[model samples]
Target: MPAIILDDISFSYSSSPLLDHVSLRVGDGERACLIGPNGCGKTTLLRIVTGRLLPDRGTVTCAGDAGPRLIPDTEGSGGSVGEYLDASLRPLRVLFTRFEEITARISEGGGDRLAREYDRLLAQMTARDVWSLDARVDETLAGLGLSELTGPGRGRSLGSLSPGQRGRLRLAATLLVRPETLILDEPTNHLDAGAVGFLARTVNHWHGPVLMASHDRAFIEDTATVTYDMDIDVWRALARAEGADEFTGLHRCAGNYSDYLEEKRRARARHSELHAAQQAEKRGLREHRQAGARIARGGVRLARAEGMAKKYFADRAAATATRRTRNDDRRLEDLSRQEVRKPRGYELSFPMNPVPVRPGSALSARRVAVRRRLASTSFDLARGEHLLVTGSNGAGKTTLLSWIATGKPPAGAQASGTIASDRPIGFVPQHLPRAGDPGFAEEIWLRGIGELGRGILHPSMWTVPVPELSAGNQRRAQLAMALAGRPPVLVIDEPTNYLDLDTMEALEEALHRWTGTLVVASHDRWLIDHWHGRGLHLEPA
Candidate 1:
């Protein structure tokens, strides 16, 4: 039996439909990845499939008799990591509670009706190996490098931990559940490179199916057996408009993430070529039809010879022909069914032309640092060169970026070093304040929907209230805002945190072609390694 199945699922929030008659299935032992840009309804679709959210129309079925375990993107009803981890092992907790209850009933001289139930519960606990539950949990935590979550700092609230820590904690707890099938959402968001590697290996070795939605390219390459992409539908709709039959909906690409990209690229190119040919054919037909109309307009001799009403009947026939021409494309109806306009993809071009630099470095810092955060650092960055600052969580990577971007120490940091250059700097921070005014989305977006589509955040999300979008999309929005007015010196802190794979690739290309100085602070090994410029690795003191 399939691990999960969804048929004719349609879900909508507000007037815009997110998922329209979308159907998906994952078979036994199949690792299927649902990938699209942020807010493309991947999360919503996962929720529906996992039974966390019901579709307005359709049926979702899962073969997991005990129900599949879902690892949500966000932290659950907030608690200490220990409490959260413990809560995940609900069956174990229930077994302990039932055992205590049975003992109490027997001691109180309860009747045989209770005795029968008590005996059965005891046997159940033994069979399930409930006694080793705590040991399993401990082992899981240790394996995930999250033993500290249950150690001295176990009392720490989940929210207090860094995003990466909380994410690892969730993964550790979920793994302990030992569900037959797993539903993971953005599983790589907060994971560092090491944890991602562990997760990839673990998932690959698992016995059951794994359904995940993520924008992590490296993770997907390591883990996915197949990829499900809804964005193909959008592209198909474009092709269908041009009377294309080859590409029309969600595509399941075989192999891993890299293979998926290559396959999709080939398919898209082929579809475009077919569409172009169809457009030419349609144009010729229309021209031929126009010639027939011209003949009718000239008052054809046949009209008078056969007494045919050329003005009336011929015009009606021409109208019928035009209707047939318009309806010839069967897939155009797919584009007409949705209220949400498909976001258009655009090529983003940054406009920053800096004057020629002298023989000296573009930026030079003697010794400046964030107070109690970063050690006094010194580095000289030449013009048009790239620099990456890498460190683990709480290693003051952001602090270094801030100091360089502003050419002064951050508020809490002290500086004594002299940094050169008066070039304008574009700084994208790790955290972005939410756009509270909903109209802000409209104002900035209405002016740049085309450009917005070029980045990770789609243009369709522009009209929606900005506060409601994911943290990653919000971050992308800010980055878009920053890049709109490109500065000569670009400084970014963790630019890859919440972006989809395509957006990351696009930004990488942009950064490579930039003619100005660039400095980035990120845990994204792929991005950092690809830059291959200079490195500044920080270790916690």
Candidate 2:
């Protein structure tokens, strides 16, 4: 049997349906990736499979020997990173629990009765090498870049760690468990290039079933053997007899990330070629039919009286109208019978607005330092220059950005010496409250519609709540808000979060072309390697 099976599972929130009849199967030794825009129910699907959540309908089956384990993106459970990871080792837990029971029986003078049980448990722990749980936990923490948070003289409570650190902690915990099957949600969201690389090696070599939801192209390419794309459109129309619309469900592709990309490109090209051919065929048929009708009409005119022909008899007009209507109907029927699909993408194409940024120092930080992460360093960014900040998870990329965007230091970071910037900055951080008024997003998109193009926002989605949008759409909306004012310098944090590969590439290209200074905190390797920009590489303190 497959390691995990989800059969026609359905789930919903109060008034909105998130997933409909979702089904999936994952086998042992295969890492399957779930890729799509945000808000596509990837997290919910993982939860259902792990039995953390119950589907509104249908069932989930796990064929693994041990209970499945998961690493959720969001955080609420509390513990130090090390403690959390230690707790995930179930075999160790079993050993410890039995040890306590054995000690209690000894105290109660029932040692003989429990002696066999105690010896068996001890022997099992020794045989399985469960005593080194702490060592394995430490190793995982270091691999995930949580060493700073878990090492001696460090290790804050999970609540005190940043969101990114918490995500790393969860990942460490997941890896420590070594379950027969692993379920991970947005596993690459808060990781730096180093941590991502480390995790990629661990996952690629893991000999268990892995089901992961990720938007990182490189990570997916490195680890996944199969790709499952959740359907974007849940409102698919149904036949009149069916009454209600049903979801199109998960779209499966049997290849790695690169294969999926190549397949998509080929599909689009094939569609374009077929569409052109069909249009040409339709035009030829129409011309031939029209020519035949003209001949038939001419024959009718000749068959009529010579006197009537001179007047071009009224019946000739009626016959011409009838021919046109008949030809149009036949064309419609022929077109309907032809099976062809049009290519669809993000469908957004537009040039960035040109802004006359003053040619001078856009921003400068002299000997800037964050408490534990960013060391004192001086950097100058000139107008129209692009600055790429690179570092690990707990590094101070976000902290440094906040300092530049705002005049003061971020919460735990500090800036010293001289810092100067005359250019107005627009910053898009990793996290922002969803726009309260959906119309606000609508207004911004509308204002730039003439220059931004119509395909950026669908008319039907204008009124939907911003939080209801997929992650990619939310990023697009936030970008619209950031670009609404067209500031001279743009400071963005993790701009590629939750974005699909196509849109991510588009955004990177747009920033490359925008006529403004930019300071960005990003972990996307593709963006880093391809972007023609200056850099500040930070090492974790």
Candidate 3:
């Protein structure tokens, strides 16, 4: 049996239905990925599978009575690192204690039942490698780059750690728990290259099923065995129905991210061809019907003319019109019943507004440093130049960017820096500040994203609360707000965090052509590989 199964699941947050009869399954040793644009119910479907939120319709079934376990992306509350680690190993500890008790009872020769229980406990311990549990825990922490926290930093409070560190810590604990079935939501969101590689390896070697929702293309390609695209439109489904594949909500593709792309491309080509042919047929039928009507009118006019010749001509014309009308009506009915749906098209062009600034140094910084957070650094950015910042987690990428854009150090940290900018600077950080009453969605509509934004964010979502919006949508809205002012110098940290491939590619194209100075910090391997810019590498202080 499959480890997890979702059949005909339907869910909605309001009148706007998010998921409609979506279904998927993951068997033992299979790794499945959910991919789509932002706010397309990837997270929502995962939530349903994990039992965090119940579906409004349909049912979720697991191989066993227990449901799948989720590896959360954030540590919810404050605690010492040591306490959190101990909590993760609590299940093994309890089992060990039970094993000891059973052994004692068997030694006392209590009964046959006690002996049987001892054997069962022994088997469980061996399978889980309880004797080497400590070593396994240590290895997991090291692999996820959490060794420092488990060593000298273990006594520190979790609140002192950066967001990335906290997320890594949570991932480490989940790995140690070794749940039978694993479900992850954007597991690579806060991971660096090394951590992401570690996760991919773990998932590749997993004994049970794994399901994840991720925007990391490289990771998905590396680990996914089957891909489930959750953002299918009815029109797209209709187009696919013209061929062998037919689905309403979820479209399943075999193999990894690359295979999925190729299949989608071919499907789109077929849809376009079919749509064009259908359109031509419809046009021809309409013309024939109009011609029939004209003939009928001519017959009426001829019948009014005086004489036997006119009467005979009117009869012939009327018969011909009647025959044509019947044929046109039959063909039109057939065409209507078998009509092809128009394929959904994407308009991916996002042209940047011209920056109004004199040609010179756009930004200049000297010996910028935040105490205990960032190492001293300096750079000169000219107009139309792009600068890419590369670093591992906790290497002060965010600190450097905040300082560059605002010339102010982070809270509780002192900084010494000399910075100047000739024009206005726009900054889009990884974590945005608390949104106000109008919310990010409403703000985006008010400030208008032109043609490109509409493609990513549908008009129905304009009234959704900012907090209710998906992470990717929030990021898109933040970007739109920043671009509305048209700053000559733009600084963005981890701009591709929650953006899907479509939006990411569009943003890359816009940035490539924009005539402005750019300072970008990102850990996305795909983006870094394709970036055409000067590089600045940072190390942890």
* Reference-based lDDT, each prediction: 0.68, 0.69, 0.76
Most lDDT-accurate candidate: 3
Model 3 lDDT tens row, 328-398: 88987876665667876543333354745467887788888887788888988888789999987778899
**Residue 146, candidate 2: alpha-carbon lDDT:** 72
> What digit string (tens of lDDT, one per residue) describes model 1 on residues 161-207?
87677767777766666566678888776666767777777788765
Candidate 2 residue-wise lDDT, 1-541, digit = tens = 3388888888997676688778888888889999776667888888788887899998888876333444433367676654555455655687778888897887788756588887877765664456776677677778877778656624456677887877677677667655667777778776767788889998887766789888888888888899987743311211111333433567677889888767555655665676677677777777866765665455555566577563575466557757776877687576645525444555543334465766778888888777676777788888889999988767788878877777678655454555687545676778753443322555543343232223455555555556666666666666665565567777889888767767886677778777778888888886776668899888775
Better of 2 and 3 by lDDT: 3
Each candidate's TM vs. the true structure? 0.72, 0.69, 0.77
Give the higher-TM-score candidate: 1 or 2.
Answer: 1
Candidate 1 ranges beyond 4 A from true positions? 65-87, 90-135, 143-145, 151-167, 238-249, 279-343, 352-360, 370-372, 414-416, 433-477, 480-486
What is every candidate's alpha-carbon RMSD to the true fold?
7.4, 7.5, 5.2
Better of 1 and 3 by lDDT: 3
What's the residue-level lDDT of 392 in candidate 3?
79
RMSD of 1: 7.4
Cand. 3 Cα-lDDT: 0.76
